[model samples]
Target: VRVLRPLIDEAGYIEAIEDPNAIVITDTLANVDRIVAIATTFDGEAEMDAEVIRFTYAEAGTVATAISEVLGAAGTGARLSVDASSNVLLVRGTQRDISQIRSLARAMDTSPRVAQSETVSTSIYRLQFGEASIVADLVRNTLTGSTDLTNPVAASVGEDPANPDTKIFAVGPEAAPISPVSVQASIETNSVIVRGTQRQLSEVSQLIKALDVRRPQVMIEAAIVEVSGDIAERLGVQLGIGENSQTGGIAATSFGNGGGALQNILVALGQSNAAALSTGLSVGLASDNFGALIQALNTSTSANLLSTPSVTTMDNQSATIVVGQNVPFRTGRVTTDGGNVTEVIKREDVGITMVVKPRITAGGVVQLEIEQEVSSLTNQAVTGAADLVTNRRVINTTVLAENGGTVVLGGLITDDRLQSNQKVPLLGDVPVVGHLFKSRSDSRNKRTLFVFLRPTIMLTRADLEKAAETRYRRAQSAETAVQPRSILKQEKVRKLPLEIDGLY
Candidate 1:
């Protein structure tokens, strides 16, 4: 590394030292606002006039009055006052003669420990460290007995003056330099400063660096999870449901969890019940109730159990449900690995998983396969020993239906008439009149293994909400005579008039 020489060479040293109005701030200022005022005068023709300035110091009050009398004698129209509460010195003077006032202040500063004035007889050195006052005190004590240094003034820089961590000292030749190599410190930084012969500064530098060096501290910050600020307002439980006019259908799709995309899907299902639509069939009832139910299911009804705006159903006599399991298939292939011939066999699972993929057409037709799995338990007698047996049934079928329509998988299978007979214990045994005391009840049950499905296309959240609202209203209106149109119209105007629905 190359060492750079100071810009103040021997040739320029004399002129630099002779320049006036050169304010060198080495330690904390008794008055900090003066520097600010000086900088404020840079605009326009502004100059520091006989500006009234306030100063606070720990010395006797006479010092302030004395400064006032001196400024008055200098004919600068400067006035000094003492604030009673704070004991601060207030000085007012013409900006042009501010430097004169500073010089007078230096002379008036009677502290024997503080340096009174800058002179060619003295060289300034500043030492700075992080610890409060300790480093400056150490340096002062280290050279306290030496005759070369005088008026070691240590004070904290910046806003905190009482800290006394940083200091400046005037050290010069009480006689002459002991060595030829020159060394000087700078005023531009808050770090250590050393001024003397090169060898002296080098020694001082090593000591200062050693004192200032400290172990680096390591800090670890925990991770932060950022959530939307409006989450509570927009996704609160009240707005999550249909109660609020905004954020309808539980707002489940608005957020995500650690599980990724499908995390809130279950919540959406509970709120909207849109996962799988359900509809039932009644074979032979002497009433138009089934028709009304189906009609209600086809339209927007408050009772969602019947509503089927996107659904249609059909009855059938017989249907099939297919079951499939994937089986691994293997194939052997010859390949070259590192210039060596090798045969490798790869096995892949390739079988149907019983999932029916519907083929949708532009004409609003959906072709799909329906599968049903049924299991039954029965008791059997094998070689005079009773045993439990299990049987499984699988039915598969492919059918075509319009979009939003249902297809029954199986035709109606009617069971034989089942009879329940009751009679008096003894009277039923009388052969002749057993019929009089006995009562018989007969019931026949018919079942059509079917699937009622209506697959409607939902493009957006609003569409889904509309479908969910229709189902919700239908479910609520099951026992009432309210019209779906009224609900829709009122909901469009306001918040669905939940009071009128009477379903909070």
Candidate 2:
């Protein structure tokens, strides 16, 4: 029992975390002129009992998907090994091919060495349930009001009697207490966690997918300046994106292939594919614009916030950060009460509450109403309320330049518009469509009914069972089973926008 404590501890996780899943695909097919070639490969056998998985987490979306044309184009063997719960193809099939997946990683005017690997995954979790039949069972239990999600220790189960998921294992050595993903009360008033429900997580995943598809398409309207030799170095991404985000790719290319050459290459971006390009790009602490973006976020977004903005300017690169929140009223652009300048601040209506209603049951209705302290609420007549209006959502800005080049601006956002509900597609290349997802309900205080909103992903009980099975087998087979990293739920200003572009 003592030997298996660690593995057993993970058994408590019932669902996947509601977070953006970023992938950095390596470009192995880019030529000197920066034209990338995308190839495709095939699998070992035909699609038979393919799973109908959601790749994310929650309920009903965890099974493997069926083999179809929509999935065939992404890769070869990956199309066949479709476990919907995990959304990625871990298949063993034909040789490596790179035909249908390349994209614009750099400017077309010069040969950019920037490249990405073929990424084939969406976020999903591998869990071990003590005796729950399937993920669908838990979903039904949560939906039907039979399970008390507030008490993770309670047996909130579904109606189905005989459904099981991927990760299941017979009783084994006693393990450590496993902790599941959860959304607890935070210190921030406007901040609401996208958590608990399967649907919420799925929606957040789909929103990321949408942003992934749109960022590259957005045309960069910055004034294009003419630079002579070795200019790509001058076009430094200023956004404080971390080394793991969009700019990360540029830095890696700068180091991997050669630095100065990338600067000389020309980069042309269109609004249509800006989201897609952002997926592969990694803008990090190296840039300046990122710092500015952080300073712009005024709406009280998180509790662990650095109230006093951090401003640091070193050498040619500079970062200025100023963070404040205009709560109980809609925040507007910063304007000073001065007679020397034109209208700098905008006006706004004031209120102090966020109402959330959950559409969970097939036909049932769930209503949740929450309001801040009355002292926090103020009418339009209140001070500073008239000076707040929404013009732009650019918060947390950073400006960057490297090796003597023109500077640029980059920022991060607190209230994200891209995250929504849809079961993310698995590893199949076919035209991937998201599944139906929703956030979980907060039924802890039986005396009061409130819909606790958070990012959610769906998974079937079968998927959990399978994940348990995977973990159990690995534990038994290898000298030490490699446990998946745990996802923590917290929010802080993004120091490096590039880091947001995650690398697996």
Candidate 3:
């Protein structure tokens, strides 16, 4: 009785009678029932049956607690416990109470089901920047939808025995269940028709807006420069030709006796001064000394600007430039039974080419994947071969650079030495005294090629306008440079008429 007092007190019941042999507890119907169940279990007088039921989907602990509360409210003396590891519920009570609990558990333990009466609506969303078919596919992948109705359903039909024309239909539980959401794309109209609930439509609208925004643009500027001997050394060491320089302009310099050749080439191309060369040189030069330094180098070494191409493309899109021709080469020859031979020729590109794909990242950094190649047809051919040989230099790599910054893509260097002697054939073979009869000359040629690339990201109209202005300025400078040459030619023509008249 004393031990039962503590249990009754904990159950919020007052024990009205406490004796050595009997104890009486009283409370609300639910609380009194719970206290009596506990005392009966302690006294070994309650008939209890234990059953373990495993749930397939519903959580065991949550279900057990819910069932326990319901049984307590109904004044049923049942004990429920959960085995979380096995996801099973343990029920301990009288046979009738356990039976009721099992029934309730079976009704509650099921996979979550969707509402069959949800209100569905259809909406047509027109895309501004993205293709309708593409956006539709993206939406389908993002949301769960029903299978196509065109697919066969799991059902069968049988003819009635009594009446041959009568038919009996047997449908499976899953037959012809329609989903609450559906999406279709109309390519001709450039819109998507979506049938779904309000929540689903809202989500689809947000996703389409995020994916259909305008794509940014990128301007890629490339420089291909070829230098030889002392010019290559000076460009590499002093000008930092292969380093990253954030400047975006062109500069020209010549070395030794190459000034005249450089000037002639520039004139022929109708360009002059800085506008005629590569922007890579402007990376390391100061404005105050730019002219003086170019003048000094103009008298020493020679360099050539092979090509300077500027291209603009959408971000993450590829741009290609080819500055050469396609030449045919023999691939194979087939002899026919009629005593005729046929040659299989394939055309291959021979010249300079560049392919670049730029991706703009956070903080205005540009990641570039570049493939550049310089190939040329060679005069050297195999003795019995039908195809001519070729020399190819290729660079394929990826690098990171800041927006409006320049980076060197790669370089190719080659060296060749030649020696020649002229004398009487027999005299050249004689030693010592034969030296006067023979003259020997030796020469070396070294050349280096550097490729520079710059990427400029344009996120707004102002950026694009700025880029266009820069290019316009360069064009104007080129036109100004060619003006003087044209004037000189005009003056020469004018004087020719005067000189001819005076001679007459």
Whole-model lDDT values for every prediction: 0.38, 0.26, 0.66
Residue lDDT tens for model 3, 1-504: 556565554545455444564556765677678777777778653477889988997889988888877767667877788889999999887888889989989989997775543346788999997889999887776653332211112221445699976534332254323334577899999998888756567777887889888889998877776678765765555332212223321212211111233333333323346334433322211221222223323333376666777799999999999989899999999999998999999998988899999999899788999999887776655587667887777889988876665566545776657778898788877999788888999999887776767677888887887776655544444444534344343533322222222435
Measured with C-alpha atoms, the lDDT of residue 114 in candidate 3 is 59
**All candidates' TM-scores?**
0.24, 0.14, 0.54
> Which segments of candidate 1 are over 4 A away from where they belong?
1-356, 361-364, 373-395, 433-442, 447-450, 459-466, 472-504
Candidate 1 lDDT by residue in tens digits, 1-504: 011113223332211123653333322242324443443444324433443333333343666666666556657655556666664555555554666665565565553442223212223344443342455455554544343343224221122267555343334543232322122334354444444444455554565566664322111000101112222232233212332223233422121111211212222213243222222111112222223324432342221221121222222212222223332322444557667655454432221112244555557455655554433343333464323333333456766654333233323232335778999999997887988988989976433222234344343455455555655565546535554554343433333444434445
State which candidate has the highest lDDT. 3
Question: Number of clashes in every candidate structure?
Answer: 32, 153, 8
lDDT score, candidate 3, position 380: 51
Count of backbone collisions in candidate 3:
8
lDDT of 2 by residue, 139-178 (tens): 3334334222322333333223465432222212333111
Q: What residue runs in model 3 are displaced by over 4 Å at the alpha carbon?
A: 1-117, 144-180, 239-301, 380-386, 416-443, 483-504
Better of 1 and 2 by lDDT: 1
